[model samples]
Target: MTRNLLSILPVLALCLWLCTAASSRLVKRSDDLDPLEAVVSQLSQTVAGLQAEIAALKSSKADNAVLLALQTQVRSLQTITAEHKVAFLARVDVDVAANAPIPFHAVDFNVGNAYDPLSGIFTAPHSGVYLLSTQIFPQFAGDVLVDLYKNGGIIIRMRVFDSTSPTSESTSITDHANAGDKYWVQVNVGGHIYAGAHSFFSVTIVFPDS
Candidate 1:
């Protein structure tokens, strides 16, 4: 269809003619003009078929390039949508009494506004599978029991009791959530639960629920 493609046809013809001419001499065992002419004619038909196939391939390559570009755009849009996420990290200066909830004051990042710092609750914006993670720092060597709540129900519960030094405890879980579902963490049993910049709560949509 294009001039560039048309040009290849002539080159193929030339190569075929040369090949036939050489074959004729070897087959006929003589440079007789009549035999060589017959061989060249026979090769023309075969060369023409190859040229047509080449043209079809060139056309197909162009079409495939367009499809690849469209796929790339779709993948880019998916990545943008995946950014519906929220992460909060802070040190609670106020003492979170035992058997109470500790509301984080600092919000490191809430790109989707799903987390409310004042309320310390993360509300899902859409129905999807979400990955939730939390890290806590307990300062004293005592019984520590923390829990994560999903819609006022306990979904994740952690218990640590030791007479040693302070240590960190963390939990990660995935959940299928609906729009407006609330999730939060609370201290179940711990006298001195120290949370600081290292402590964090995060949630991200792994995939939308179908």
Candidate 2:
């Protein structure tokens, strides 16, 4: 039995050595690829590189598209803003602190240099269709008569009667105007108007170059 085991061990060792040498030879053969296979591998790598470049180019085109769209939108907004304007004025005085200033003065927001606080006039900044609104609130129980004038011509009149108290009366007009056209609110000489924050005059450009 011992001699049989020793002989089997020698056969096992010889088999292992042959297997290891065969594996090493196979590894070297795999490392030395044929010319055709090498060219195919190179072509595969180039194709992968080209695919990556194509993907990058597509991504760049998408980014450029988004940037162009944003630029166009910004330009449109700029044009609209340049053509639009608004002015607002409200009276805050109750009586003539000194003497009646005739026309009411500015007490609230004014934009685009459209309204003049000292003259109480809105001169058009561009040729457009304008919306003019006037609000009147009397101080005492009396009749109110005020007119909205364009270039010294009356366009709208607001008439209201508050016997015991003051109620707000408002009127508006949409008028086509040219650049430098003048607009204002006028009260009749006999009309009694109360000046307070509730009274407002406003103008807005609704359609530019209309």
- Candidate of highest TM-score: 1
lDDT of candidate 1 over 1-210, digit per residue (tens): 556667777876887768775775665534666766676777687667767877788889999999999999999777757665444443455546666556777776676788877767888987888888888878777878889999999999987767678777889999999999999888888766775654667787887654
For model 1, which pairs clash? 91-196
Instruction: Kindly provide the TM-score of model 2 when superposed on the true structure, using C-alpha atoms.
Output: 0.59
Question: Which structure among the candidates has the greatest lDDT?
Answer: 1
RMSD of each: 5.9, 17.0
Give the residue spans of candidate 2 off by over 4 A: 1-42, 72-86, 92-102, 129-131, 162-164, 171-176, 205-210
- Please give the TM-score that candidate 1 achieves against the real structure: 0.69
Tell me the spans in candidate 1 whose CA falls farther than 4 Å from its real position: 1-46, 49-76, 79-93
Give the 10-residue window scoring lowest on summed lDDT in candidate 1: 85-94
Worst 10 residues of 2 by lDDT: 94-103
Tens-digit lDDT track of model 2 for 1-210: 334444455555555455545555654565564543555555555545555666677788899999999999999878877768665665645442222223557457777878876777788988888888778776556676767888888788777765777677888889998989998776663245667766777787787872
